[model samples]
Target: MWYQVFLWALFSSMFVHIIAALIAFCRLRKHKIGAAVAGLYRAADFEMMPFYALVWGVGQSIIVSFVSFTRILATL
Candidate 1:
């Protein structure tokens, strides 16, 4: 249960970060990023670490799968 709670908090933070990034990316056009906006961008960038861990920890296979999927979907 302890580990479960920990994972829950961890995943929550990760999800929040992803949501924040989407918001920042969406807002980047209209607003100039001052200190606070910069802070939000920085936070979204920092979220990559936890996001990577959460996703990669699921499995290497999934990571590879996703890379391919993203390339195909985004055509990037």
Candidate 2:
């Protein structure tokens, strides 16, 4: 059960990260920010942002999953 919760949280975080990145990219492009401003806001390369976000999100989800599993265990 803990493993399942962890896996679910990891995948959900990845999915959410992808969607958020896409939306952010679209908004950034739509506004036509200057190259310098874009560079300042997004220091990392465009191709790497999504991967970075996914990794960060997954890390956060791991903590969340652990906490949730502990809570469930405590209730029983």
Candidate 3:
């Protein structure tokens, strides 16, 4: 039971991160932020330790995604 719960949580987090990364990339492309920054952000996301990623990464990713969402809505 405990193992199942852990696996579920892990799966959910991975899904969230994948979505967040997609949003971040879309935002970057829309703004033309340059390949260097885009590459750096990608590197950072991958290099981030799992523990810290689980704790703080979600918040950061969500914030970026939220800002992108609002910006898109604002233009319309």
Better model by TM-score: candidate 2 vs candidate 3: 2
Model 1, TM vs. native: 0.39
- Writing each residue's lDDT as its tens digit, candidate 1 over 2-39 gives 99999999999999999999998777766755557668
Report every candidate's CA lDDT.
Answer: 0.80, 0.83, 0.84
C-alpha RMSD for every candidate:
14.3, 10.6, 8.7
Per-residue accuracy of model 3 over 1-76 as CA lDDT, tens digit each: 9999999999999999999999988877767557776588798886766887687878898988998978976777
- The per-prediction tally of clashing pairs is 0, 0, 0
Give the range where candidate 1 is weakest over 10 consecutive residues by summed lDDT: 29-38
Ranking by lDDT: 3, 2, 1
Q: On a 0 to 100 scale, what is the lDDT of residue 10 in model 2?
A: 99
lDDT, candidate 2, at 51: 82
